[model samples]
Target: MSPKNYEIIEHSRGWNGYFKLDVYRLRHDTFEGGKSAILDREVLERGHAVAVLPYDPVRDEVVLIEQFRPGAISVQKTYPDMPLWLNEIVAGIIEDGEKPQDVAHRETLEESGCTIIGDLEYISRYYVTPGCSSETVTLYYGRVDSTNIGGIHGVVDEGEDIRVYKVSAEECFAMLQNGQLCNATATIAVQWLMLNRDRIRKETSALRP
Candidate 1:
């Protein structure tokens, strides 16, 4: 699929902030024929990140986080009922030379004060918004002990004020069906958990730590 059938007619920098936006005047291979017209498109270089859903199979619970997302507020006019503070799985951006697994564990502890132990199960790697943003999330499922897992945790310097909580796996599935887990990352992770919960619970190695 990596064919040299596309041309970058021209590209210019648009924004050089937290997210770098670039305007591209390019043509790419078309499904029906040769190439598309040199149409202009703006792409945001948001970089890649990692996510992890920490589960306590013994307790049948999953750790979750709540935070205010300015991006959601920015789109409030279009979706007037959109919420500002959203509940989601723990996640963070991957720095240069950092592995996705490492970032997953790091974010879990940073956001929820829970350390992921035992075998880490990989869930998925996907683009959050491929149409306009170059952001992708590598998702995982990690084992944890939720005996005393509850807090509001996050790096103060990062301006991240995160509230952490745990819920029964059954309740999480219900939330998924009712659109409570609205974010793509949380939705995907919970849906996967719904299908694989039994197997995960049966894994003695996964219920420890």
Candidate 2:
């Protein structure tokens, strides 16, 4: 049994800001009949994004941004009757011609009001929701100093109302355990940090020579 090959015959734009129609001819081989079959499929044009999990080893805190999510509102009636807002890590869509690392740094500052001063550690890149959406997100980890972070931050033009919270790693873990934090990105990042907690602490503690 060999892999199937697809050939695109035609494509067109869709209503949701992506390619809608795609005519594909697939080639496959059958062992029993020794025959070939053709199939068709369509794909959507998706965009890329970036997410940053900013950690402050000195304070043992991770920065989280809180904002109201419309999607949450639409689905809140299913369970946990409450507001549709959420607390998540600093993240944003990668603008055209912007590097992923740069976008991570930019979104960190925009959402957390703190500057990242350490090396940007690449974590993992993943599809946000593969079932219906075509959005890929690159994740990164960076050390930041939250010593003087106190103020409202977020893009005004984009109608972003973000509140920054500097909570200890222990508290973040507690939130995860208590069901207070349910965002996927935040959960993934925090779990990663939990796994590498010792190494991150040691690396951040080593003095520059």
Candidate 3:
């Protein structure tokens, strides 16, 4: 038998615009087989997104981009010397009717001018901020050619001013170790690559004729 564990008391809109904020009043079953008291929670509705770290196994390098994040303004006040511009992996929200893999390829070229070379290696799928935001991200490690992956690239209408560049895998990992990388997706992807780089390099090398 299955238990109906949750009940929604009320669902309402807190704010709706470029992004949505919703309010939920609900109650759910507790661990001791009891119903929890009614709770009020505000959730930011960001939906789904995709992020990809571009790696050039042949050159032992990675493609990264720096862009100014409007949300970082408040963060810089609390964190000492926090730069307004953050280095991050290529990412974008998944549009309606669009596939995650398609968004990975599209954003990679639009943001970094780097085209993926092979199938993307799936890394993880996670909620970015489970406590407050309804945003989940699908992450990947994409193979690319880093030979010409340097310049400023982004859609002009989107107000993006991105500076793209390539760095040796060693340098990228060192940035991770030194607390220089702050973007969540970048942080996760880099840590994952650190563990899997050896196998990834071997596989890529095997493909070389």
Candidate 4:
């Protein structure tokens, strides 16, 4: 249903930073065929982002990066053993007038030093948190050669301290299974590759350089 279906009683704005928050007061249709009472909701207005998983089908290897995330520390505060640094796929925000594919390629190079070998195979586009966030992420699987794709790489000005890892696809799957790949994007990417590895290998074998 269109958002027009809701009666916008009021709209307000909140924090503005890397993301903005908006407050909405509205009411919508009900299953009983009557409009409900006004309800207020606060939503984090995070812009869309793109994440790409680099895989070398022939070598059976994958490129991943590890970086510290302060958000994780804030959320999982009770667990003292919780790892603040997370292993994740290459990802970046879509800059003004930039496409998802462009960000994917740029992030892959900056984070892991692996250039995307061919056209990206789209995996999924999804909301990271719909309950109170407007952030949506687009995912892709990019073919890459995993040879010598390990080191520290990232934009110094961005304060990004990234460590790249080139691991066998089987080992990556194991990480996913063992909770090492706890981030949402990495988990989803690894799961999709696990199910489609053979077909992907066959389809991209000839495309390898």
Candidate 5:
């Protein structure tokens, strides 16, 4: 791909604690010709996060977390008669000096109260939103025991109140089909599980002779 001509003029933290504004000067290279442009862009530098889809091949279940999001409150007011909370995979931002896999493992424990055993399979990495934000996320798949999970778990200091659920793979798939699962990260993680369910089940079932 050809490189686009763009220069960052200035960047600084915005009034909001979550984002920064970036001023840029650009020379657009359209198919027909080139055009000079100057524009300001807001970039969210929340940094990278990790999302883990914990699946139990033995029981054919998937672990999910349900939580109330302040971001969803505005949309809930639009309906005025429905709940705005969401069900999503265990996710957390990468802490300083923390690896992505470590973040996934730590979040799974803190959010779901389940230990992730065995290797973590990488799914994909992509920008959550590129239009005006710079948040990138890494997705992964791993195995967890559903039998030992119970009760709600979350970091109180961060004001997170999360409920953990262990639902069958079939049920999770149904939720995805019926539009119940709406978040992009959860959708991608669940779909990845569905695509690899059979193979993962078979491989995980067979042990070394």
Candidate 6:
């Protein structure tokens, strides 16, 4: 295996709004044991985010939310089959001095009207597109009672029009297979839950009220 190495030479900030953009100039060691010329790369600086899959041990269901995404709209221009309304787990940007699990709990309530009880089990952390964006998401699975979790939720001031849905684990998998839940965070969380759901349920069973 080849050694991985890179040195950042410059990071010039461009835009600063909902998300920031920066241009980098740097170089790295080539596979041939040589240094390549300095290269300029533009990166979207979307800070770290947190996502959680709210699961009900008793009902064996997961809570998901549907909302419009402008990013999906841009993709739809090139791929018409892509959906503008995305189905995703509860997610939000992590604020300074806040832990990922805290964001998961807060977002769950604001986005799905569901309360995440018990300790949140960390699933994984991943970058959305390291090649062009500096966005990484920490994913988790939190215990919740999904029996009556379906409803319209989300903070109105933030322009969030989220519709919550509580579906069985099987249904969530089906949605993923059929392209309904194609977002990265939700897809990863659902797949992880599918693999460890039984153990998660058993461990959290005592914590549920």
* Best candidate (score: TM-score): 3
How does model 1 fare in lDDT? Answer: 0.89
Reference-based lDDT, each prediction: 0.89, 0.79, 0.93, 0.91, 0.85, 0.89
List the candidate numbers ranked by lDDT, top first. Answer: 3, 4, 1, 6, 5, 2
lDDT of 6 by residue, 1-209 (tens): 58489889997888878789999999998888878899999999899999988988788998889999988877978899998899999999999999888898899899999888768888899989999998999988888888777879999999999999888999999999998988888889988988998897787676657
Error of 2 at 110 (Å): 0.9
lDDT of 6 at 27: 94
Model 4 lDDT, residue 100, Cα = 94
Model 3, range 145-202, lDDT digits (tens) per residue? 9997798999999998999999999999999888779878999999999999999999
Report the number of clashing residue pairs per model: 0, 0, 0, 0, 0, 0
Clashes of 5: 0
Measured against the true structure, the TM-scores of the candidates, in listed sequence, are: 0.93, 0.83, 0.96, 0.94, 0.90, 0.93
lDDT of 1 by residue, 102-170 (tens): 898889899999998776898988988899988999999998888898888999999999999999999
Model 4 is weakest, by summed lDDT over 10 consecutive residues, at 1-10
- Give lDDT: candidate 2, residue 66: 86
Instruction: For candidate 1, list the clashing residue pairs, or say none.
Output: none
**lDDT tens string, model 5, 1-209?**
55465555565666455544554444455555564466666666777899999899888999998999877888777866545778899999998899999999999999999899799999999998898767888999989989877678999998889999888999999999987887999999999988999999899789525
TM-score, predicted candidate 5 vs. hidden true structure: 0.90
Model 4 TM-score (2 dp)? 0.94
The list of candidate 3 runs beyond 4 A from truth reads 1-4
For candidate 1, give the lDDT of residue 75: 82
Off by over 4 Å in 6: 1-4, 205-209
RMSD of each predicted structure: 2.1, 3.5, 1.7, 1.9, 2.2, 1.7
